[model samples]
Target: MTAKKELLGSLLFAWGANSYGQLGLGHKEDVLLPVRVTQGLASIGNIKCLVGGGGHSAIITDDRTIWTCGSNAFGQLGLPQHLGESTLPLPIKTLNGKAVEIAAGLRHALAVTAEKGLVFQWGVGMKSLANRGLQTLPVPAFMSAREPCEVPGFGHVKVKHVSAGAYHSACITDQGWLFVWGSNKYGQLLSSDDFLPLPFFIQPHHFEGEKITLVRSGWTHIVARTERGQVYTWGRADYGQLGRKIKSTQDSMCKSNVIQSRFTPEKVPELTGASQITCGSEHSLAAVGDSILSWGWNEHGMCGDGTEVNISEPRQISFFRNYIPAAIGTGAGHSMVLCRSAGQSGGDFKACPEEQAVCQGNPETATT
Candidate 1:
């Protein structure tokens, strides 16, 4: 009997801000169009996870190894600080064949190991002034670590997923419990305290009897999805990062006058049956049913509205109406979707319809 050949590697396409070569395209030029990343990931095996930070990116393969590229400033790429940066995907020997999930923040990164489920963190630590106006009262810095260090706690529980915001981090255990740490300047941790240097449980009561299955963080906000497909968000809302409207009296002078931030999690009424959720620096995206919805900061058209206006409410991205998103991701100023053609099958890749619309009749620029 002949053995079946194992399929190696998967196609990855990236676009948007590449000022630091975060797209792994072997160059530092911005990609206005989705381009396949083939420079350094040709033999890594099927990709398990992909994430991007402010100016860096990371990928996890089926072998459970990590490959990183782009800015390594502050050592966010899991490489030696001296290496500085790389435009090609380089294996992170420290986490070889151990990591199951990974997440990237603006200046830091986190990973969950497969064996003990221990969480590892690297890059710059979070810090914020207690009172910006009073330099003497400034909060102490959290101390940066260039190499991976096991995040204290979670020794007994097995973490299944991890997430990182610009300065905060979070993880969900196999038991469906959520723990968060780092900056709470905007109450992202659901605490009155300013900063949490160590991980702390979010309390089961806050979830209202429903276990959280997944969580994602923006620069200053968090969004979580329950086992029942219900979505909740909290933290900063001045930019409408929170999907729900802040409670306020009808007689309020104006929208700006009302307190927009939510210290605790609240249901996102506009989203239902969310299968996947991701957060950018100050924006969010979700795959619901067959469509994708986006909200929050849209200064760079990341919301897919083709406008630079900030989106205050969850709106369907018309550009993807004809496609069924299999997975969705967001960056500080960009968004990406991986989907198959509507009628095509058997692992065939389908280029974004918008890409086709823009490149049509231009043979040299066709994505497929």
Candidate 2:
């Protein structure tokens, strides 16, 4: 096979502040556009997935190996024991098997391997903690995290998906089980109706069985949409991110505001026929029947809508309604969406629908 086959495609990167060379654009300037990341990885091909942590970033391939660059201050790069910046792409040997998907927090990274279960993380973000130390790749302390610990769960169960947020992480198993961990500052870890005020620095059972088909983690909240298309959310909802209009309910998991804490999952009105969803740092967007609506934070026009610097509740972004987004990715301050124009054709490969979970990453890892 050609080398390109192994590398996926060309590397893609974008950085708002490149002072630490997080954008890998060869210079320490803020990159406003997505550019090629050629510092470390040269032989890789189509990038299966991309994740950002604080200022650093990581990309995984079909080969199962991971390449990371940018920030290492908190070891978000997933490289060896190092601080500073990578300046180039460095290989992560710890994750050898094919990684199906990955997500990033402010200072940590999470990955789900083809092996069966998900791997725990040891780095920064909401989970960062008193040990707020840094490492290049995962160290023994990281792998065996204690408080805000990486506490690898799922036992032997097969994890189907995983997502990371600013201070929290989330996942879904093959059987449709959902899990949450880290930062409870906003009750992001309490998945159930009865939640404690204390946030588990480690993974905790926020909610039980909801038959979730997909789950995505935001900077401070976690969203899971069930197979029947029912969306659930936990964590902070300062901007009505829970989808439900802020009301007088002051119960934990169901309550919001200082009057009552511990908000729970509530149905988002008008978010119907949603095939998929992704979350930005504080806001959220869902692809519903060829339309896109956003809520929560929109401070920098990240929502793609014309104005409204901040979206307190669910709002519509009509700009790209007609374009069908095949896939979507959200960053702390930015978002990436793959819009497959209708009538356009490519390699003999026909794109798969969202239900398949066909396998995330590079074409090398794609299954027929």
Task: Give the best candidate by TM-score.
Answer: 1
Model 1 agreement with the true structure over 113-152: per-residue lDDT tens digits: 8778888888874543223322465432322556676887
Which candidate should be chosen as best, given lDDT against the real structure? 1
- Models, CA RMSD each: 8.2, 6.7
* Per-candidate TM-score against the hidden true structure: 0.82, 0.72
Off by over 4 Å in 2: 1-44, 81-83, 86-90, 125-140, 143-151, 191-209, 249-262, 306-308, 316-322, 347-350, 354-368
What's model 1's TM-score? 0.82
lDDT of 1: 0.69
lDDT of 2 by residue, 1-368 (tens): 32233222323334344555554455656544333455443345455555555566566655656677667776677665655786666667766456767777777777776765655564644333422422242323543331123344466667767777776667767766666655455656654422221222223233344466667777777777665565667667776566655455445453235423325565565665466576767767776655657777655455667454667666666655545544445555554444434444421112433212432211122111
Error of 2 at 137 (Å): 24
lDDT of 1 at 122: 82
